[model samples]
Target: MVGCARVVNQTPTLPIKGESYVVLPFENYTETPYAGYRVASILEGVLASKGYNLIPRVWSINERELAVEEIEKLKESAVKNGARYIVHGSVNEFRYKTGLDGEPAVSITIFVYDAKENKVVKNVTVSGSGWVHESLGTLTQKLLNRAF
Candidate 1:
């Protein structure tokens, strides 16, 4: 696990229709970096499929791409790329015993920001025990529902 993000500048309002945006790589606060990338990809696909104008995932993302030191630069890049909103997310993957069963569960949190306002329009956190392959899809849908 790594450092967690300190959220800033939040708003209670949600985004309207037809807003363009980019799905930034979900910050990796877990032991595995690949898990973070997978989370990000899930977010991008879900948001796009739900009818949001999303930036292509493969066209603009990588591990360690958005350092804490580059907040301003990242914001500028997102704006220049025609993103009216920016999606930031994180996950904590863990395993715990539920009665007789030992299962893997993921706790995910996602933030949707209105770029010009620099405010978090939506934030969601969800956790459930299951295989990553299946849980990822459920978590992705939850994030998208909150985001849109």
Candidate 2:
């Protein structure tokens, strides 16, 4: 219960215009230690490919624990970095299926926060499994495409 923040009724399509944003490292709910960072990195590239102005990883060090602490101080940090928004979330699942024909799969939730207002502007969950021959990164990209 802070600021005028509330989840929007609908998630916006990607490449949000006229906004400089930062992709904060995401939480990894999965057992894989690097899954969160891996996905967050991929997401940053995807957003940039789609024409979004994303802050570089060098600016924040891609650390989840640090991001959590920084959320309380997001307004000041965002202002310093010239970022109007922050993207962060969790990787619920990141692994291949357990079967004779295992396929890469991932479940992730993404959120866009209005840094200046300290409010979430959008939230989206995306989950999917790829063909047996697909790589994890490729599968993740497909899932993100489906999400946004």
Candidate 3:
């Protein structure tokens, strides 16, 4: 498989009601520069569009190598900023497929955590390929919706 994502815990639903969220910077695993920022921006836009208040801040820690202390600090900051939840993510893949079609492709993993409880709520991995003519942002949004 090109990509996959799952929550570490048993939470099956996200807090989709009247809750606020903070989106941390996503770690970009691919060679494409700014891919991580791109994913983070998209997530922020989508969440805001869904009627969630977004905490206007970017947690600039390395998501892949975050330590317990760093995570605690982040959670505390989010709580202080009045965010009910925070989202961390990684851009696992961000490039066009190398073939005749050269389709735009993206793979990402997102983790949602409860700011007050300092525990994960849900995580999801989603990958998608778009037609040669489609924009990366549109394809990413479609894939994200599927994951949501």
Candidate 4:
């Protein structure tokens, strides 16, 4: 069996490097519990691996969607942390489909918010499916790595 993954869509320009960023937990819209947090953790690792400076913060709420108030709060937190950018978004899908192969599918949208400007600088949506033998987390990481 062969495992495969592909990026569905993404913006042409990447976020500038050498800027400090604060990564907020992604909102989970999937049936799978804590899917947002799971993806956020993976994204943090990916950013760190790429040598991006990350500002650590503790988020107690597990948001299921990105409400306007939530976004404002996230922006405020990013500004307080002195981060140039805020990273967040939502997980639209995260699960293994019901089929003979049972492929692991993941769909997520990422947003890069400019803390100083209080605006979203860039946004990208990417999705992929893994082979039957592959794991969901591994596939998710692969797809996110392509976001930048």
Candidate 5:
């Protein structure tokens, strides 16, 4: 929320125009890591199609390659790879529940930060009851629009 800002409610769509960017894998907070990675891959492809530069996350740490014992070592490696804008995204919580109220509930939160600015470029959560699944793609695209 500084120099320039805009929000486009179209998820899973490419941008009309702009600068390049790198989209990091979103941290999966669900019961399965696979679910998290699946979403990340989708996000990556969408952004890539927009002509933004992207950095593959696993190419550096190799998933669990760095433990608490190797923080320092990994730092150097990440830098050597010529990373400028590091995308630290996460899906901290996802809940789908149906109770006595007979209404289903689902929520997904996505965050994108600008490494250089050291500020949260975008922070928002999308939620709905039944049929919320249809909005996931739309929500992600909305996040990316603000991110770039």
Candidate 6:
């Protein structure tokens, strides 16, 4: 069987093409180690391929999940870095189901903050299931592709 993904929720407004964006480290709510960083890397690649100017950050392996207050600080840092938009979210699920198929399942929520307007311009949630043969990374990339 092939993998499939669906959008759970999304705002009407899409991000403007060719805008400068800073992708903040996503919060990892799941037990999977570095799941947030994995998704963030995939998201960055996806956006970069679409021609968006992405500002890179030096990631620290010791960094912990971001707190609510840290999100505001990250947005401010994005603005200071001359990014027009800030992207961040949380990884709600990233694991394989323990059924006979051992199917891979992933769920994530993303938010796009417009620095210029000082508001959230977009919000999207996506989830998917992959066949037993599929890898979690591949399924995650596919789901994120559907998101933006």
Best by TM-score: 6
Compute the lDDT of residue 60 as modeled in candidate 1: 52
Q: For candidate 1, lDDT tens digit of each residue in 29-142?
A: 766555666777777777777777875443355545456545446656887888888877776662343554333456677788888887887876655555333444564455
Q: Candidate 4, which segments miss by more than 4 Å at Cα?
A: 1-5, 60-71
lDDT of each residue in 82-138, candidate 2, tens digit only: 888778788888898798767777888888888677788888888777777887899
Give the Cα lDDT of each candidate: 0.62, 0.71, 0.75, 0.83, 0.45, 0.82
Query: lDDT per residue, candidate 5, 1-148, as tens digits?
Result: 1121223332343323343344444555655344344456566776677676765553332453223335334323444564444444445433344454333232345554444555555544544443434344444455544544
**Tens-place lDDT digits, model 4, residues 1-148:** 5656667676677567788897887878899988888888889899899888888864654545456577668768777778899888899999999969899999999999886777788899999988888899999888888886
Query: What does candidate 6's lDDT look like per residue over 69-140, in tens digits?
Result: 776687787788788988889999999999688889999999998888888899999898887888999888
| RMSD list, candidates in order | 6.9, 8.4, 5.2, 2.4, 8.5, 2.1
RMSD of 2: 8.4
Return the clash pairs for model 5, or none.
11-141
* Per-residue error (Å), model 3, residue 55: 1.7
TM-score of 4: 0.86
Backbone clashes in model 4, listed as residue pairs: none
Query: Which pairs clash (backbone N, Cα, C closer than 3 Å) in model 6?
Result: none
Which candidate do you rate higher for lDDT, 2 or 6?
6
TM-scores of the models, in the order given: 0.69, 0.79, 0.78, 0.86, 0.49, 0.87
Question: Against the correct fold, how does model 1 do in TM-score?
Answer: 0.69
How many angstroms is residue 50 displaced in model 1 relative to the true structure, after the best TM-score fit?
0.9
Worst 10 residues of 5 by lDDT: 1-10
